[model samples]
Target: MKRRFLVAFLLLFFSYSLNIYAVEEEPSPPPNIGFSLNLLGPIFGIYSLGVSSFLTSRVQLGLNGTYFDTRSVDPKVTGWQTQVRMNYFFSPLYKSGFYIGIFGGFESVQIKNNSGRSDNYTDPIGGIIPGYRWSMTKKLDMLLGVMIGYMYGDIQISPELSFVYLL
Candidate 1:
């Protein structure tokens, strides 16, 4: 009798479990593009702007331009750079999370010596960047990272901070 009761209870439990239902949620669409401005650059006499687009849900393509000048210091330096970068995000969404990227670009710099003579040079630059991005609001976000790269035949590490406005 106990064996018969156990089999009946098991069958009833399986039938009830199979009738249970679950609801699935739909995901929001990924962001298409974003524009970025470097806030820290202005504090150090550099101005920069960038635009980025989503190539897929987890990949992005970006272009940036930057300019800087130091007129008050001896051996004053002035320069500009244009870069192209591709980022692969770790999270499912491309707009926010941790990402690793590679960037390559061309840069030009002019140095003015104490003798008031200016010399200009240009070079190709490339780097690897790893960063974290967080959303501030529905349409605003911030990125913080470091770029380690070769520029002007020297290995340089630069801090990266920017605000992105999504559209």
Candidate 2:
């Protein structure tokens, strides 16, 4: 009798376990706004934040802020910068493959000169930014770019690298 009962219980458990009740749902696509962080800058004590939003398949708007310390540069300088950007993508292979952008912003920097004097300047800045963006995964992306800007009353070039998460 005990053997018979155990066999019956096992059969019933297996029958119920094999039945399907609910189906799993698929994940939704990524959102339009992507928030990013600069990994390269932090190694030298500059912290940066960036955001990009898709206006259309070919157009995107972006903004970036950098708060920097002297650890990054020779002769030791400290400053902050803010930029506003807009990009137009050209490559058809991927909507974000390559982009040309224009950016305008302001930056202030202070440096201590060898004469035991600290000099600071605030400059109006504008730049042409060209970049390439590639999807690392469906929801992740990487952007590599360069900016040529007028800052401190002079022309300057800066490199950019960012990891982004699509919202």
Candidate 3:
């Protein structure tokens, strides 16, 4: 009986030691930086530039800027916007593909009337924007999204699309 107990204790101790010494997997490295730019139309032109850094293989943090110009009417309207995003890649790293994310940012709008009309109002605007991104390559990408919030006392909704290139 004593021999059996001694053998059992030795077995249990060996198993416990093995469990403690088992190898663990290392964490994945972060994502590299990326950028994109976009043209809406002849009346509307937009530029978006950003950087994406991987927090993990699947997740990333991004900072971006958007510049918009509209020239449909006699007056030309322009806006400057900025955003920060968190992204998730659908596929593994080193694969050619795309990524999606949620973003929020600040925007400012200004309108100028080339006609020198009395109806023109020079004002500075502010708002919030949300959007998503798709990567065509490691250095180039496209994004589509919207902005809905308050600019001055008015509620505005602006939809935007852009392409970006990493440097």
Candidate 4:
């Protein structure tokens, strides 16, 4: 009976020690808040800014806003957009690795023609985005993704490229 008890105690102690070591080996949790800017927005005549927060170790929620004017390109388009999103990261922590998300938003656009006539419209938009976020430095990350969904009764696909600063 004593031999059995000794063996059981040793096994339990070994298991507990392993658990403690495993916990110590884990990476530190990421920051809770991040600010993001769209890198391609300026080139396309759109300016955007966003904020995101970690809801859980693998989940994050974000809000973004954008304003655009394309008079230089053609169609003389001007618009503003706002969106909110929730993402589930496949990585062990937030703002890293592969992620899939859903977003819903609204946009208002105006187009002016050469004849000086203008058309204005507003629409609600929703989509699914798949992306990857990589660390650029200790506190910066770059995200690359695509949004696919419905807008103005039509299917739309848009590319996304952004940089995030974690705090």
Candidate 5:
């Protein structure tokens, strides 16, 4: 399944390259709020959602929500998180090309322990994310990113994928 997804993504990714060399016009990217998803978290049973807004060709700001609930795994667990993200794309236009960004927020997590005690906390979060953004059409924009940051004061890594409609 992962291979299929990667193949599909690459196909879509390359579909746009054919236009990079064609005649170019005005750069019109998303300037409004964009709804997105964190595709990498689900592999670990984490589900996340996010939203963002672009200020120009080089700046963007957004927020995300993440949740985890498992009953079939060894220990039952439940949790949620919220994060704020800001990014800068080095492209020559708004909402297109490679990017580097930062994020800070908080998370509320809970895990069922063998001692019958649930561990939980709401703590500050921070990270540095590097990614790419692009469009295959006028109405749809996509993002592929990886986040390496701190959560609960611990270093961690996260991969992400998002699709946002231009407004």
Candidate 6:
């Protein structure tokens, strides 16, 4: 009777311990997607937002839309532009989060005079936007960068500062 009681107690204890271990397993978190709002200075200003997802470990593809406004010292030389861009980022497989990439896309610009006269133009613009992004937490980041390129029959170089929130 003593031997049978001991075996039964041991089995119950082991089963209880296994159950507790199973219940303590943690669930994995969802993958992170990034978004940003950029301010590109006085002569020209742009606001852009995008989402990126990794296809491979080091390679990501993203789509971005930008609303751009530009004005010369003369109000008669004001223009509005819009663009859709596709981007690719290359870094080490494990270090994909910190790196730079080249972006290219289509842009349309409309320039108007306060006199109510308007001119419209469309073109392909490509440039390098070099910047560093640091993850503040799982859902917030700080982005600082600059973009230099050509558009609308002139060369463009703009400095940008932005705060990004990931959802």
lDDT against the true structure, per candidate, is 0.75, 0.70, 0.55, 0.74, 0.69, 0.52
Which candidate order results from sorting by lDDT in descending order? 1, 4, 2, 5, 3, 6
Candidate 4: deviation at residue 24, Å? 11
Instruction: Report the C-alpha displacement of residue 14, candidate 1, in angstroms.
Output: 39
Model 1, global lDDT: 0.75
Candidate 1: residue 60 Cα off by (Å) = 1.1
Candidate with the larger TM-score of 3 and 6:
6
36-143: candidate 1 lDDT, tens digit per residue: 899877766778999998787667799999997867666676899899989766544523456667899998988788998887769999998767777677678787
Please write out the lDDT profile of model 5 over residues 45-83, one tens digit for every residue. 878888888787457788888888765554555778798
Best by TM-score: 4
Q: What is the TM-score of each candidate against the true structure?
A: 0.73, 0.71, 0.49, 0.73, 0.67, 0.55
TM-score of 5: 0.67
TM-score of 4: 0.73
Model 6 regions more than 4 Å off: 1-32, 39-45, 69-98, 112-119
Candidate 5: Cα lDDT at 37: 70
- What TM-score does candidate 6 get on C-alpha atoms? 0.55
Provide the lDDT at 50 for model 4: 93
The 10 consecutive residues of candidate 2 with the worst lDDT sum are 21-30
Report the lDDT tens digits of candidate 6 across residue range 4-104. 44663465456445544442422134235656666444335444666665554434456666665655533333334443433332222222133344567
Angstrom error of the Cα, residue 54, model 3: value is: 1.5
TM-score ranking, best first: 4, 1, 2, 5, 6, 3
Q: Report how far off residue 9 is in candidate 2 (Å).
A: 75
Model 3, position 113, has a per-residue lDDT of 71
**Where does the lowest 10-residue lDDT sum fall in candidate 3?**
117-126
